[model samples]
Target: MQNQLIAFEGFDRVLNYGLDRLRCPSPVGVDRRIRLTQKVASIEHINATMFRVVLDSAIWIEDEDKPAIIASLIAQLHAAPDTT
Candidate 1:
């Protein structure tokens, strides 16, 4: 099995980049299984009102559904409210 992970700072950029990366279809000639996991977190700066966004993803290579799964996770995170 293989795993792939990613992190992003901006909400919009995270979504855009995640989707673009997921556009590639078919992990051909690969025998290993793949898994994907994504997470988003926000933190507030002590001196600033703006919140920082963190996007994380874990995936395994050769997983056929990894792209769609990761994309969905990213979308959900983007839709979530900013806690910070």
Candidate 2:
């Protein structure tokens, strides 16, 4: 049912951010229940079937370092997981 609903969890967090029910981007539906302990931000649910997740804060890399840092992140995303 997870692929049906919407949720995001990572980095030692049991549940970081998610929508209990998709309610079409409204003040009545938007809520922030997750608390992050590091540089990651909680997901922002914008609509009934839409979400925004910011993986990292700007603290890790400077303005000039963003290119390299972004490239590294992209490579990791496209890279295969390690079994060993």
Cα error of candidate 1 at position 21, Å: 14
Any idea what lDDT model 2 has? 0.29
Estimate the TM-score of every prediction: 0.27, 0.23
Tens digits of lDDT, candidate 2, 1-84 = 222333343322233343322222212213423221223344555544444554441112222222212100100112223457
- Cα misplacement distance, residue 69 of candidate 2 (Å): 2.5
Candidate 2: residue 56 lDDT (0-100): 42
lDDT of 2 at 24: 24
Candidate that would win on lDDT: 1
Error of 1 at 71 (Å): 13
Candidate of highest TM-score: 1
Please give the range of 10 consecutive residues that has the lowest summed lDDT in model 1. Answer: 68-77
lDDT of 1 by residue, 1-84 (tens): 112455443444322323323343444344666566666643433232333334444454653544423332323223234577
Each candidate's number of clashing pairs is 5, 0
